[model samples]
Target chain A: MAGSLLIELDRVEKTYVQAGVDTRVLRGVSLAVGRGEFVALQGPSGSGKSTLLHILGLLERPTAGRYLLSGEDVSGFADDRLSELRNRHFGFVFQSFYLIPYASALENVLLPGLYGPESRRSLEHRAQELLARVGLADRASFKPSQLSGGQQQRVAIARALINQPAVIFADEPTGQLDSATSAEIMQLLADICTQGASIVMVTHDEETAAFAQRRIRILDGRILDNGGPGPAEG
Target chain B: MRRALRLLPRVAGFALDAVLAYRLRSAFVILAVALGIAALTVIVTSIDGANRKALEIVDMFGHDAVFLLGGDIESRAVGKRTLTLTWDDARTIRQSIPGAYLAVPMRAKSNITARFGSRNFDLPVVVGTTEGYAQVWNWPLSEGRDFTAEDVAHGAKVGLIGDTVAQELFGDRSPVGQIVFLGSLPVQIVGRLSYRGLSGGGGSVDDRIAIPLTTLAQRFNLDRKYFRAIRVKFHNPEFMDAHVENLRSLLRHLHRIAPDQPDDFTILTADQILQFLAMLRGGLVAFLGLTAGGAILVGGFVLANLFSISVAERTTEIGLRKALGAATWAITAQILAEAAMLTLAGALLGMALGMGLGQALSRLGILEIQFSMKVFAIAVASALAIAAIFGLRPARHAAGLDPVQALRRSEG
Candidate 1:
């Protein structure tokens, strides 16, 4: 919070009500990531890693505590404003590689810029450049189904970079890939971080977590350790 | 604004592509909508045409025309009394009223048998005035001449036959200048009238025969002083209420009736006939409306079901769009646009089919089909409204989808 932190969570808590019963998901979670920091979150399933990621990504609001994005308190913001913040400031890559099946690889990569003021010509060029950076330029016109699993993940990575967001939130980016493909995706994500962008990846794979500059582990909705070596070779 | 407009066509194109992807199912839905619209259009147009035809029949008797009839038949029969209006009263109305144009005396006799050669038929024969009959009533002569003042003055034995009478008596032969027997008297057929076909009342005036008033009064031994009724044509139709009031006061003074007593004679005006026709048409329109409403409701159900299935099939697509930074409004707008586009397509196609069917019916001489602009507007507006009404819940369901659950479901 002292040095222009890009994200700050002040004792954030979330409780979900189902069937008239309250289940507490996050309990007083406080965290921050400064500009250009690659922070990896590692935890077992149901440890609230995904819940914390959702709150950080502005997809959900915490029931209690204040959340700030780039120094602006966003916890009480309206849905539209939160959506705008998510669009302008963050990119997401999911485990399922949620690319629109009907759109081509280039269209999928260029989809995020459609809501912004970017010209079609410029967006197309940027998408091509990103696809080439990910070494799938020739597969730009292929649909997600026509591409291999590794290639589809590559397209997802390229899409995550299309808006040039301040941070990319990759939740299990390599969960659906082989070891070699996982390594390739990790390398691509690390390269994106090197280009002065931040990344916050949530993965259970210790090897994948090791590629980040900082690794944090959580248990029972609370952080257990920080500044630990992950399983990935660095 | 320009970007939004550009997106409209793209969104519409996507909608069309989606519909085309399921060609058979979409086609069936479109056909269903079109059939409903066509039925509604035909009923509305046919009823409207019938109303117009009825009005035209009333207009044939002249504008602002009123028929003064004696005491109600049921009341007179029940009370065992005789009450009638006289020719003196008709003359008084013509002379005293400032707005009155023509006050023609009429004495109608029912169940008269007329004969031509070997053929014979029974029809209602109206014996009316000769001098002002054609002019006051605006009856057009299809063939030969109408009764002249000389004919009525001299009580000439000449007559005008309606199309139905001429057809029945003469068959294919021309009845003009021929002699037809009317109640033991041979009356020369001087003219034949054009067929004034069946009006909304289900009665045709073309089945009757018209003769001079003096001839029927003198020869047939009908009541001379007390004619059956007086037919008064007025100059202006809008002043009918004022004229009716004037006629009532004048009649009360002439008849010496008490102020509180009911009128012995009732005045029937074209306005009353028009009102009756209007009510009839309105009822028919309401019936058509109820049917159309049901059709639209069922169409809406079909649309809602289609949209629900569509949302189910595109859960993953909705999630993808959300993850790509699409606003909720944008997603909702896309689904609404698809519904509207489908309904609009159905409406246009339906209108075309309706007009075609109307034309076919017209060709068959069933009705004079008129394509009203108002009907077209209503059809299109209702189609769009139905789309919006039915499309809302499904579109909202699609828009409110949780991104995580949606993606997970798609993967599963």
Candidate 2:
């Protein structure tokens, strides 16, 4: 797959107002992600890493500045249009897996496609293919509660790719997994990137950041470093 | 296109799946809705059926028929008035009003005992004119025949017994041409009347015996000018109002009453009875409507409580769905759909239970029960409306959740 620019953020800012006091989270942050790139965001707790990820994933609108996704300026897009763009062009994975507990693994994977106008049969087929790609083909009918944490995260990843989006935004995707499962999930994400799907992951762990082709560290809502010489000898 | 239509079932299945997730809670909510709807159904149907039955009784009396009863119109008075309507008045009304079809003079005596081979039963005795009597009342004869003009001219000692009277006096034996002693008069039973069943109030009209007016007057020594009441039937049913006004004028002239004085006689017609029933049905429907509305309000409260709790329980899920590209409207639609599904299911169950209860009650001789499509449609529509109205706030709350805060809260 050809690598190209997929997301561009220019002078983005997010402010939190509580009790008549405004606290700026992201201060004029600018960033860009190329297609099929494996990028990692590294930051400590309360460093606005998650907020930046949310803005990039189209889940939150910046208080100021422009966000362009796949050459379309989405700064003034309505909620519905933003959602449509997200569903069509991007996918999401979270640290907690966030699978709907009452739904089966297959159903959790099929959730993103449900809002679209796709037929049920086609949606199911796509969900099954993604689950099989995640190596959980036999566990499609099992509820999230019945699956292990690692397996649930894998289903979440499968859900993220069900729409065949151009980019995947993973917020601490392996934060809740064991080291062995974490490595396996990182390898799986890397494999997806190799298959032409870009990924932007947020993580605090240096070892998790090492799996990415590029790494950026954020501090106080500002980029402290970008494209560093890998994970500090760890 | 056909495939999309077929997918409706899939959507419905998902809705059902969501409802069944909390089995006990959903069941309780549905049960509450069902109970309210059922009560509403039975009450409305029974009252409507009773009103219809009352109208049928008025129709059985005759078309365009009016009753002249003695009463004080301005004040409520106790005991019967002594001012009687005479047989002469019946003749006068028949001759004076060209629109009059038949005028029959009637007198009634209650609780008269009849003896037949030591079997005795208390029955009502109705004495009326021999000519145009059956025509004016529209009474159908089940056996034998009705009294003719010859019976009145000769003052014959013959009588007709109703179904209930025949059953009591003769049981299975044929009552035609049999001698039944009516207060030691020993009147011969000439015919047996058909069963007209109950007249809305569940009182059988068949438990009465009819005798010729001339025979009754002669046997009891009652004067011709001192009869009980006069029943007038009009030539055309549509001219009942005009005929009633004409009667009022004629009575005012005959009784020598002043213009300011209220007439001593009251004119009663089937339309008046119909109007009374219409008022009664309207009152009943309104009462049922209020009750059903209150029940739906309670259901709405329950749904609001349920949705509020659901929003709290699924906060993280809402965040996750939003992150997965779910719009605010999509999230809201999901919650609202769940509520509507629950309410619709409850309404269907309630309608079934209500109709069943109504049928059982009717069989037990309680209120008369009926089923109406309009009522069922209203019940279901109200249920959906209640769900939507009450489910809005919680749905909006769920949709407006911040993905970052929701995720952080869930982890914490």
Candidate 3:
């Protein structure tokens, strides 16, 4: 499945300098995600899982090593070019369901499209479609505060799909939800994966990681094990 | 550039949402800016009114006329009377000065009571002058005839009453051919002067009566040897300044004053009155202009501080926006758009407030405020400039925030 890889990381390294002390977050991390593949990064606290996700999602640049998206090296891209690529190709869902507190669910879903090439009139229609797909079409005009934890996460998922990105990067999408709601969110993510969009999710729970076909475990700043490939990784 | 243009409306909508979300903070900025803009508008409009009034005064006091007033105007104490000017001086200026077309000597008294057929009113002013007084002052009678030189030579009791006196003393009846007693003497009304609304000094210009100079001297018990002032009209108003200087030297020569001694009379022109008005306006401008500047500065300072605090408070939001693929320039543009919109609203409110006061002052006859599109343009441009100057720092700070660190801080 690596023959049609959507993303590739070759010895990526990230370092943070704080108070004259260097903290290595990701060291010599090499990974790849095939098109439509579901991958879960599992690690304990301080395992640098979130940092790796951020670098993969283009929110931050690695200190060294090459990052390839669609077989093209993008590690040396400028800030604006990187922003353009992220807008066109990547989506993110944070742990806190980071919807604009003042905006409605539909408005939150339309945010990504606002920065993309689509016109707002067309984006509105697509945002409604995405919200309906997430099964909260009736709550389109509700603010984030008015929704429950599971409902808010669903809205966040709808927003992540607004721009029709090639890959979705979700950082602990259900970390704050109960077991039952967490299972529901995982099922929704699984359903989305089946629709031909790759997903890279970070979680500490084994049950959550079970939803993904491949699980990559990390400790300290290095990958402990890249879980054996699933049937799609052939 | 094209992408930024397309994203402008979305960014502006985001900005408006933030502004609406924090209503209290937004109102604080709007109120501060509105007060400043209102004060500035009032001051600017008032200055415009003062300029218009000055022009009206110059227009009323005939552009080509030079008034030679009795008493040392530069040195005299207020209300102290002088009687050095005479008809002889008027004769000399009209005969000697090359450009002098006609010089009309005048004597005036205020608070005179006139009576006619049991109706009486306290007239504001009564003037006594020669036959050329009507022509030199450019005041044509609306009805009847002007008094001739023969009337002045004979000290005739005929006079021209102003519209106010005619209306007050005779109702709808014709004032001509009627006799109105001036104090204790009966004077015949020969004509009615035209209606003139208000004087530059804000008193009714139509409240005065005109009579022969000799009649005032004999009937009013004034000294026949001297008069109050002499108004000299020049043929060429373009060269009136030179004519005024020539008249001043000639008056000094005729009065036989030594070069060291100041003349007891003052020469006045429309320019002198306008200069006096400008000096008065200058004091008002300095005081009011400083006040306006201080208000604007305080308003800008408050806006800048509040924006900085808002940016600091929304760190997580900014991070989320960046994560959602918003560029650095988009964040900056959103903050700037918020500032511009708030100030624009404030400018409109301020204009309405100031114009309200302008209408009141205009009604009170204190000033005549000129309402024009220029004022609107100035207010808007200044508000946008303030938004640019004060809103830049906070917008840049928000745009420069590190997304990863911002998100981490919020996670706690």
Best by TM-score: 3
Candidates 2 and 3: which is better by DockQ? 3
How would the candidate models be sorted by lDDT, starting from the highest?
3, 2, 1
- Candidate DockQ scores, in order: 0.29, 0.48, 0.69
Off by over 4 Å in 2: A1-3, A228-234, B1-13, B79-83, B112-131, B149-157, B164-174, B179-187, B213-227, B364-366
Alpha-carbon lDDT, every model = 0.79, 0.80, 0.87
Q: Across residues A119-194, which tens digit of lDDT does each residue of candidate 1 receive?
A: 7788889999999999998999998999999899999988888889998999999999999999999999999999
Clashes of 3: 0
Rank candidates, DockQ, best first: 3, 2, 1
Candidate 3's error at A173, in angstroms?
A: 0.8
Ranking by TM-score: 3, 2, 1
Model 3 agreement with the true structure over B59-79: per-residue lDDT tens digits: 778899988898888999777
Q: Residue A183 error for model 2, in Å?
A: 2.1
Cα deviation of B293, candidate 2, in Å? 2.5
| Residue B190 accuracy (lDDT) in model 3 | 89
